[model samples]
Target: MDKNISFTLKIWRQNGPKEQGHFDTFQMKDIPGDTSFLEMLDILNEQLIEEGKEPVVFDHDCREGICGMCSLYINGHPHGPATGATTCQLYMRRFNDGDVITVEPWRSAGFPVIKDLMVDRSAYDKIMQAGGYISIRTGAPQDANAILIPKPIADEAMDAASCIGCGACVAACKNGSAMLFVSAKVSQLNLLPQGKPEALRRAKAMISKMDELGFGNCTNTRACEAECPKNVSISNIARLNRDFIKAKLKD
Candidate 1:
């Protein structure tokens, strides 16, 4: 049976993007070890509502770790201390009784905090809109085996396609660079036949948009890969650099 534990939560509180933020302490007692991190927050919110106090604000959706909406910086790690997992997947069992857990929003210039733990991650969407898709139609959907993609190449593309746009890379990076995210998106599509025609243009446009949005340049620190929930590789960044340089050379 899972035992209940107690802890102190020091969560960041902010009214708006421009407002100053600070930590608000809350005591959580007798929490089930199996309770998910988000479930614990829900219990706290319920307690606050019953007491007629304002509740903490945070972003979460599809708690199954797919949407990447839970942008929590828990104890200095993006999405808690769990490896290859999102915040929603984190459980209280990871911490011991009476531990002081600190929760904060992603502290990047590109991902400004909206209120408390929620930040305006629309910058990612904007970067995607810049050139993350293949506009050219590859005709009607055909059989999966028709394209004749080799196993190794197809596997690499699938791995790159696993990026969920969580922005954990930005939060973990000392330079707040989005190269990992952007590179994953680029590699997934560029590796396939349908996206090959415009691979260079796609890479160039997305990178330009990332820079225009004030995201920092990649400095080879590889912190982004270390903290990425999907473990998106920095090698993709190298591929992005090669593609970008090729595009520039053509110009």
Candidate 2:
């Protein structure tokens, strides 16, 4: 049977990157349990608009667990208490009636507050710009199996490729590190044949960009892997370290 539940929401609000921010509490009544977390926010925003108040600002796109745009810290957990799920995939049923849910943005220097829950995650884009690319010959369409890859290797690469660049790992880490994100990108390409040629270059360049963006160091607490919506493995980080070391040695 389906039912509705009420919740007390304590959501963070900010005007801009340089402005001070604070939490504003609101009462949500009789919300459908099957409603997604983002949909619940939509309801609150609609109420605020009707009241002639500013609607809470947050990031979201493709609310179907892809795109990774729904980045919210709910009740001290990135993307809420659910494991392997994005905020948009989180249902209101996970909470009880009268629960106080705290919502905030990703709190990393690399991701400064842009408005309320939206942060300047362009630092991630910069890191990817530094190396997340391949140099392929201008080509006609090739056969599907033109390059025969081992099944296990292809599967591993696909797993790493599943990363949506959500930055949940950074939000969940105490150090606000971005190792898991960088490593996943690095690993996905490194495991494939075409990426091998530039593997060393990609590793060093991306890591350097990540460090330059004011993101913190990885403490190996595994918080990143635990919070990652895509479940990107920490083993990729090991591969990244090795690749970085090898790149340095080559230099």
Candidate 3:
């Protein structure tokens, strides 16, 4: 059902990384049901600019949810209250007409707020470069049938490969653990035949890089799985644990 909502928005505002931040409130009337969370933010920004105030700055790219750039901590929930939905996919209809929504950036030591709602998640990219991808040759690529991966292994790898590295797992976790994200990335490669040659190496290198980046340890609390937009299994974390142990033993 389409409805117009009148809500009060409380958004975090900051000038830069070292600046003191505060919550700024704005009220709007007749917000439509079809307006996305970012769309709502857009409306608020337009209003703020009209008032000669700086608009709240947040990260967003490819509003279709693939880019994983719309990292919003909305009303105490990462990516708002929508299950399996990114911030860009969140609509204002989910909120009450008189709701006061609190919007902020992802809070983690590794993901510090750069300005207002925009944070630096490039730490994830650094960890990936440390060891998230497979190392293939510059020579001719193998044929699709050359690898001949069995269905079960391929499917499992695909499932793990679905991780978007959105860092929701880290944000939702009490200890700020990134096990789900790292595990999925590691397990995806480890599950496949093509990934076998560097399986142990990949596990060891990725985990080491993760630790070096100062990500907190997992305590099995499962807040990560609960908030993972991709629904990545915690069992993959177990797989990473086992792989890490095996790699250490082989050292």
Candidate 4:
């Protein structure tokens, strides 16, 4: 059986993007070790409501960690101390009694604060819309073996596709670079036969979109790869750079 723990939470609160924000402290008592981080927040919000106070606002969806909606900066880590796990996967047991836990939202010029822990990640959607996909004609489904992608290449593509667009990369980087995210998205399609048609166009368009949105340039800090919940590699950035240069040469 899991034991219960207690902690002091210092959470960032804001009324809106243009409003003032500050850290509001609260004491969490007797929280179950197995309770996920979001659940503990639910408890805290419930207590605040009982006291007739406004509940803290944060973003979350599909607590199982797939949706990547839990964009929390916990205890100086982008999703707590656990590696390759989203904020929703963090559990109370990761803490100790009387520990002071700090929680904040993703901080980046590209991701403006929507309220408290929620930010306007719609910039990512705009980046994706710019050129994140291959334009394929509608027809009957193609046979799986017809494309005949090698296992190693397919695995690499899958690795890149694992990115859930959580924006932790931007949150952790001192430069707030989205290279890891964009590179991963680009590489996923770039390695396959179908995506090769627009490889140059996709690379140039996506990188241009990323820059137009005010995301910082990559400085090789590697912080994004270190803090990524999906363990996305920095290698994809190299591929993206190569593709971008080649595309420019063609233009």
Candidate 5:
């Protein structure tokens, strides 16, 4: 394979959150196959800079796929061709020489576009701030085997812990439901002993915050799990519903 491959990029450009947006086409020639997707965008920005034009801005941090900061909808997919992959982890080699790629920001009313491919995901942080953390301190240290939790229970908690709060679930959902995300958050803590103290309150607070943020209700279409970079399970949603029901019963 040639190290230098040429391609076409149709990128979304919006001046601000309030401004109307459109796609701008640019033909990239002799690009390195080794360059990551974001790196390709970097080169394109450099070219625009040399021409005395404004650079394209996109969100990115810790490109290693953990931070979930690379919030982008590339070629009709949340991240790109690779499943459970981040934009910064995507390589140019995934395409042929003449492939025409469409790059856009995550589209959702709750997440207004901040720039070209960057949207304000502070909505997630707001939801978390509502009651995502365990406030009570368990200062006294106990033995590791004191709880004797089953392996399966611990595994479920780990699965929920895998959620990175990427907002891909909202972007992929037609109704913009954050059910999968909220479910994962609740599941991680609900299944464990440490989280039992705040289980009811946590669900009520986070769900209330989610509605206040203007997110839509979950109808169980399952599109979110398909696009999620973490591959968060839909079963977590059921787990969340159970917890919510239990909380309501206590009231």
Candidate 6:
């Protein structure tokens, strides 16, 4: 049986993107060990509502760790203290009976906090819109086996495709660089045959937009990979650099 535990939550509170932020303390008592972090927040919100206090604002959707909407910095780690997991997947059992857990939004200039724990991650969307897709006309959807992609290449592409566009990389990076995220996005498509035609253009455009959006340059620190929920590799960044250089050389 899972035992209940008590803890103190110091969660960041802010009214808007331009407003100053600070931590608001709340006492959580007798919470089930199996309760997910988000569920615990829900209970806290319920308590606040009953007491007529304003509820904490946070972003979440598809709590199964797919959408990457539950971006949070718990105890100085992006997405709590779990390895290869998102904040929604984090359970209370990870913490002891009386621990002070600090929760904050992703602290990056590129990802400005919108309210409390939620930030505007639409910068990622803008990067994607810059050149994350294959626009060439393929007349019809071909059968899966028709393309004849080798096992190794296909596997690498699949691994790169696993990136969920979570901004944990930005939050974990000391430079606030989006190289890991941008590289993963570029690699997944560039490694495939359908995306080969415009690979050079894709690399240049996405990287340009990332810079235009104020994301810092990659400085070889692997902090982003260390804190990534999907385990996206830094090697993709190397590949991105090679492609970007090739694009520049051709110009």
Q: After superposition, how far is residue 180 of candidate 4 from its true place, in Å?
A: 0.6
Which of 4 and 5 is the better model by TM-score? 4
> Residue-wise lDDT of candidate 1 within 145-175, one digit each (tens)?
8788888888989999999999999999889
Cα RMSD for candidate 2? 0.8
Each prediction's number of clashing residue pairs? 0, 0, 0, 0, 0, 0
Off by over 4 Å in 3: none
Model 5 misplacement above 4 A: 1-3, 138-140
The residue pairs that clash in candidate 5, if any, are none
Query: Against the correct fold, how does model 5 do in TM-score?
Result: 0.95
Candidate 1, which segments miss by more than 4 Å at Cα? none
lDDT per prediction? Answer: 0.94, 0.95, 0.87, 0.94, 0.89, 0.95
| Per-residue lDDT over 1-251 for candidate 2, one digit per residue giving the tens place of the 0 to 100 score | 45999989999999999999999999999999999999999999999999999999999999999997889999999999999999999999999998999999999999999999999888989999999989888979798898999999999999999999999999999999999999999999999998999999999999999999999999899999999998999999999999999999989
38-119 in candidate 6: lDDT tens per residue? 9999999999999999999998999999998998899999999998999999999999999999999999999998899999
Please, what are the lDDT tens digits per residue for candidate 3 over residues 27-96?
8899999999999889888988999988889888899888888888889888989988788888888999
TM per prediction: 0.97, 0.98, 0.96, 0.98, 0.95, 0.98
Instruction: Give the per-residue lDDT digits (tens) of candidate 4, residues 1-251.
Output: 68999889999999999999999999988999999999999999999999999999999989987997889899998998899999899988888999999999999999999998899999999989999999989999888888799999999999999999999999999998899999999999999999999999999999999999999989999989999999999999999999999999988
TM-score of 6: 0.98
